[model samples]
Target: MARTAVPPKKTIVKKMNYLTGFLLGFGLLLSGCNKDDDGVTKPDGPDPNAANLDVQDFMYKAMNLWYFWQGEVDILADDAFATDAEYTDFLEANPNPETFYFDVLLFSDDRFSFLSEDYKELTQNLSGISQNNGMEFGLVAFSNSDDIFGYVRYIIPNSDASTKNIERGDIFIGVDGVTLTRNNYTELLFGDNATYTLTMANITDGQISANGEEVTLTKEEGFQENPVFITKTFDVSGTKIGYLMYNGFTNEFDEQLNEAFGQLKADGATELVIDFRYNGGGSVNSSRLLSSMIYGTNTNELYIRQRWNDKIQAAFSPSDLEDYFAATTGSGTPINTLNLSRVYVLTTSSTASASELVINGLDPYINVIQVGTTTRGKNEFSLTMVDDPNRQGAPYIYTPSRENNINPDNSWAIQPLVGRNENSVGFSDYTGGFAPEIELQEDLENLGVLGELDEPLLARAIQEITGAGAKFDFTVEMPAEAFTSSKMFSPLKDNMVLDKDFYLPEIQ
Candidate 1:
C-alpha cells in the first residue's frame, strides 16, 4: 500500500490533563488487543510466540512518533500497516527491542540513535554519572600499522588513574599484557573486567615500543565528572585571554560552569578560548547555558530552534520551536556571561553533538575561530523515550522526576534522533561537521599541560587572539587519528539530549 503519511493536527484523546498524557499523545492507542471487532480480549492476545517481544512495542511506537527519519523508514510510515494486528505482528517478529531499534526502525542515515536496556541507567548516564575507571583516554591505531594504542587524554581527579603512575601523554600498547589490536581493544580496555593492567609504551627516537611499566585501574559506579576541567587566564600581548578547557556540557556542573565564567569575567578577560578537543557532547540545555555564559544572556536572542519531525512540527505553535539564550543557570544562579564578540574554540574528531551545537548556535551572533580539526558532524538532537507505566505501552520522554512512573515491565529506553536543531538564522547543516579556520592537530610527541599556555591548540588560539604567535612548533610526529575514546563509550555524554521542559505541542 502507498504510505502517504500526513500528520493530524488533533489526534490524541487525552485521558487526563497531565504531562504523561501530553508526552504520550502523538502515538496511537498502544494497548495490544488481539481480537479484531469488539472490546473482547482474544485468547491469542497472550500468544506465547510473542514472548520476549514486550519492549519492542515501546521501541516501535516511540520511533514511529518521534524519529527524525520516521518518514524514510517504511515500517514506521503511518499507512504502512492496514490494521493493528499487522503492527503487532511486526513488533512480535523482532523479539529483541535492541534489534528492532537498530535494524528495523532506524534510518540508514542515522549515526547516533542509541538505546539503553534500563531507563534508570540511561538517565544516570545523561547526568554524567556512570561506571568509570577515572581515566579519560583515546584509542587510535598506529599510522603505519594495525596496532591499536590508547593514550591518556586526562585523568579525572580522585579516581584510580589519578592515583596511579599514569598521566596525560602516556600511551598503552596493551591491556593486561595482551597487545592491543583494532579488534581486541574494546574487549581489553572497555570490557567488563573490573580491573586491568595497562602496558605502557615508550617513544624512543621517534619509534614507539612497549615499555615494562603497567598501571592497574578499577571501575566504580556513580563516578561523576566535572565538565569544567581547567579555567585559566593568559596574558596574550597584554590582552587577558580566558582559557576554559571544558570537556563536556554536563548540566550537573552548570552552576560550576557559570562560576568559572564569573572567574574569567573577574579576571578582565577580553578574549576567550574554549578547548573542546576531547569533548563529545551532552545536554542541549547545558550547551545553551554554556553558550549563554560565553555570549550575552539576552533572553530575547534566540539560541537554538528545535526542528522536530513533521508530525510534531505540525502540532507546534511558532513560539514552541525556538529556545532562547538562557539568562540563568539551571539552579537559578544568574549567568556570568562574558559578552565577548570573538571566541576561539579548540575542536577535534571527538567534538560532536552538543559540543557542535554551541558553535552552530552562536555563529550568527559571534566570531567563532575554530582551531584544530573538523568535528564529529552530528547536528541531530535526541529524546530519551521510555515506556510510561501510567499509560500502558505508551512511550514518554524520560525525566529524572518521573523515574518511578517508568514501566516496571519494560526497562528499555531509546535515545532516538527526534529532531535536528537549527540556529536562529535556520542553519543546521553541519552533518559533515564545522571545519577549523586555523587547521592544527595535537602533536603526540609534545602533549603539554592542558591549562598551561603550552598546549598546542590553546597556544594557537592565543596566537590568533594576541597576533603575536606563541612560540610552538607546528610539526607533529606520528600524527594520531582517534578511532574512539572513553567519552565515545559513554553514548549519553555524546548525545545532544532534550529532556524535561522541552516544548511539546498542547494537546487540545
Candidate 2:
C-alpha cells in the first residue's frame, strides 16, 4: 500500500467555555462525599459562635464566586444545602488564600490565649523593679520625630535600672548576639519564641549594656524579597552563552536584571538562558519590562487577553488599552532597548502567574525556547494586598477587588473563546506550555550549577548562532550532585540545558 501524506495539524486555542467546564468538574469532584443509606443530606453546620465560622463563610463565598466566574456550573449546585467543610476545602485550593485566612485565624486564637495567661506579668515585673529603685516603671515609645527609629517599639522600665541609666531615647543596637537591622529585627526578636537579652545604648551617654530582660514578642507576618539566582556560563562552540537564574519578579528587580545582562553582554554573550525552575510570581509589570528588554522594540502582546467581571467591568473595555500600552511602553518616553531578539527559558512545574505571562507574551514575537518541564497552568491574575489593622486603626486585608484578563479579547485564547476557535495569528498553541523545540535529558548530578559549554543543548544554540563547526568549544566539567538543591544553585546550575534548535524566522 502507498503511504499517504498526513496534513499538518492545525493549532487550536483553548476557549473560555472549556476552562469553565474544567473548573466546574474539578470543583464537583472536590465536593463529592460518600452517600448515606437514606440518600438524604445530613446537617453539617459548625458549632455556634466558633471562630471558624467567619473563615468558613468567606471561603464558601469566594470559592463559589470563583467557580461562577469560570462558568463552572457542576460545582455551583445549589449552595443552600452545601456543608461548611466542603466550602472551606474549595476555597483552600485558591493560590495562597489559606495562608492569609489561616494565619490570621491561628494568630488571633493564640494571641488571646497568651494575653489571658500573662495579663499582669508586665505590671508585676515592673512593680518589683520600681520598688527596688527610685525610678518610674512604664513602657515608652522609642521614636525619632514620632516615627519608629528602630524595631524595639516598646520597652519595660525598671526602677533599680534607673530612668537616667536607660533613657527613652536610647537606641537599640542589638538583641542577643544578632545585630539589630530592619530586615531581621522581627524574625530575631519576636517571630522565633526565643528569649532575648536586648543590648541598648543611651542617646546621651552612648554606653552600651545588656539589660536583664525576659519578655515575649510576637513577630508580625510580612512578605520577604524573592530573588533570581544566576549560576554560571560557558562557551558553546564559539558562541558565548550565559545562564540567568530567576524565580519571581520584584519592584527593584529591573536593576538586578540590568546589571546581570550588562555583564553577560559585555562578556561576549551571543545567546542567553533564563531559568525559572521554581518561580511563583510577582508584578505583571515586571514581566512586561523583562519581555520588552528581551524582544527589543516590537508590539508584542504579553497575554492572550484579559477578562473583567461585573465588579471591574471598566477594565474590559477597549479604552483601557491606552493605559496598558502606556504602562508597558513606559509613559511615551523613548526607552533604552536591548538588541537581543530571543531568549531560552527553562521552566518547570513551579513556574506560574506572572512567569506564565512572560512566556505567553513573548512567544509570539521572539524565540522563547522552553526547556526542562511543563509549567503550572495558571493564566489567571489577581491583585493582592494586606491591611495592618493596628496601624490603620481599622480592618485592612488585601482583597481581590477587581479581575482583569491579559488578552485583548475578553475570552480565553489558550483554549478558545467559544464554539470552534480559529488559530491565533502569530501565536503558538501552548495549552499547557510551549514544548521544547529540541528535547534534552536533565542531568540530576549537575543540577544547581550551570552546565559546561560542550553540553549538547548549549552546543546546538551556539551552532545555530555562530554557524556549524566552530573551532573552540567552551565546555567545563562540574559535579553533577551540585544541581539537586535549590539553595546550592544560586543563579546557575551545572546540568541546566537550553533546547537550542528553537528559532524564529529572521525578519526579511
Candidate 3:
C-alpha cells in the first residue's frame, strides 16, 4: 500500500474548526469510522500491525491547529495531509520524513521542537536524570592549530568524576593515548564508552604541557544532576557580593535555590552575580520563581505575555494573555524577594530559553547587566504530550472528549513549538541573542577556580560591582580554537526546555 504523505499542495478543510476540535494538546479525529452494513459499531482504534500512519497524521493535525506559526507556513494548511495514505506515502518516499515534515511548518526557524517515543524517558530527562561519567569539559585550540586541549569545567557532586578526584581546571591533552585534534575530537571524545582514559595536561607560562597522568573513568547509570552547582559569598573592598554557579532551571532544586538566596540574605550581601555561562535553560516556572526572588515588588506586574497562533488566540480573552508569578512558590511559602535595583548575569552562547526569559522579563523593572557573551537566542517554549487516558496534569487543560478510540500503545509524544514569550512593556526582540555589556572569554589558560572571587567571570562581575570597571583583557592571544561537546555527555539531557508556561484556555 502507498504510505500516507504530505500532499504536494495545500488542502484547507472548510468544515474543520481548529478551536473546537484541537485547540490545546488534544488528539485529532480526522478520519472516523462509518456505520457497518449490519448497523453495528466498528472499532476505530488504529491497527497495531498497520503501517503506523496515525502517528504522522497526528503530527500534522496537531501542528496545523496549535503550532505558533501555523499561518506563516504555506504548506501546513488545515488537513494538508489529513489522511493515512497521504501521510504514509510521504513517509515512505522520504527517508527523513519526520524532520522534513516538522521543518516545513516552522516559520520562526525554531530548532527546539522534537518527537520522543518514550515519554517516560522524556520525563526523566526533564527532571535532570541521566547516565554518564560526569566529566564536563571545554575544548580549546593551541594558537590557531588543530591541536585541541580540554579543561574540566565542573564536577557534579558525588558523581563518578567527582569520586575520581577529577576537579575543575584539570586539563587533558589526549583521550586513551590519542591526542584530541580538531579533526577527531568529536569522534574520539564524545563516542559512547563504558570506560576511558583521560591523558592529563597542565598549563604554565601560557603553554600546554602534558602532566603524564592517565585517569581512567567508568561511566555510571542514572546520575541525577543538581542544578545548584555552586554558591559562595565574597567580601571585596567592604562590599559583600554573593556568587552562584547555576547550571540549569530544574524545579526539583527550587529549595536549593531558596537556600542559596537565604544564605545571601542572611550574610548581608548587597550585590549578586549569577553565572549562567553553561546554563542552556529548563522550566519557565522556575525562571519566574527566580525572578520573583530577585525583585519582589513586581507581583501584580506582567512578567510575560504569551501569544499563540490566530486560531488559538481567538479562543482566549484579552485578560488571559498577561501572566505573572506569585510572590511565593507553588508551596505557598514566601520566597526571598531581594528587591534589588540591579542584577548581574554571566552568560555565554549556551545561555538560552528560560535564561533569556529571565533577562528579558526582568529588564523593564531592574538593571540586568549582561556580562560575558551573547545567549543562544530562543524565545519559544513547548509542552510535552503523553498518551494518558484521563488527560489530567497536562500543561494545558485538555477538554475535548474522545469516544472509545484510546490507543494504549500511543507511546509517542511531541514537544512542538507552541508559543512565543514576551515580557512586560512588550520587548522580546533578541533574535540574535542579547549582547553582553562587558565582553570577556573564559581564561582557560588560568582557570582560577569555580565559585571563588578569582574565577575569571566572577572576578569581572566583582570588578564591576566594586567600581573597578568591567575591563578585562584575555591573557591568551586572539581567536583561539574553541570547541564545545558537553551536550554529548551522558546524563545531561534536555537543557533547552522552557516547559511550564502555556497559552491557557478560559475554562468556561
The digit string of per-residue lDDT tens for model 1 on 1-508 reads 1111112223221110001112433432333344333343322222345455558766776676668898899887655565656656776677776677777888877766777787776566555577888899888788777788888899998887788898999988998889999888888877889899989998777777988888889998778888889999887668899989889877778888889999999999989999999887767788899899888999999998878787677767778677899898877899999998878999998887888889988888998889988887777876667886344323466656677777788888777777888888888877767888888887778888888887788888887777774487877775657877887776354666654443343321
Displacement of residue 68 (Cα, Å) in model 3 is: 2.0
Report lDDT (CA) for all predictions.
0.75, 0.37, 0.65
lDDT assessment of candidate 1: 0.75
Instruction: Report the Cα RMSD per candidate.
Output: 7.5, 19.6, 9.0
Local error of candidate 2 at residue 374 (angstroms): 2.7
Misplaced by over 4 Å in model 2 are 1-52, 64-70, 74-228, 231-242, 263-270, 298-304, 308-315, 319-336, 383-431, 446-448, 451-460, 463-508
Question: What would the TM-score be for candidate 1 when compared with the true structure?
Answer: 0.86
Residue 113 in candidate 2, Cα distance off native in Å:
30
Number of the top-ranking candidate, with TM-score as the measure: 1
Q: Which predicted model would earn the best lDDT? A: 1
C-alpha lDDT of residue 384 in model 3: 53
Off by over 4 Å in 3: 1-52, 79-95, 117-123, 140-148, 179-192, 203-209, 318-321, 385-413, 469-482, 487-508
Q: Give the least accurate 10-residue stretch of model 2, judged by summed lDDT.
A: 493-502
Candidate 3 per-residue lDDT over residues 1-508, each given as its tens digit: 1111111223221110001113343332322334334442323334445565555545555565567778878756543444445545654453443565455545545555666675456545554566567787777777777788888878877778878857877889898899989898777776666678989987776778898888888767767678888877788888888888888877778888877888888887888898898876777777888888887745778888777788667766667666685577766667886678888999877676778888988888888887877776667665555443334323222232532233455555566666777888777666567778877766666666888766777888888889885466545443223445464343332233443333444321
Candidate scoring better on lDDT of 1 and 3: 1
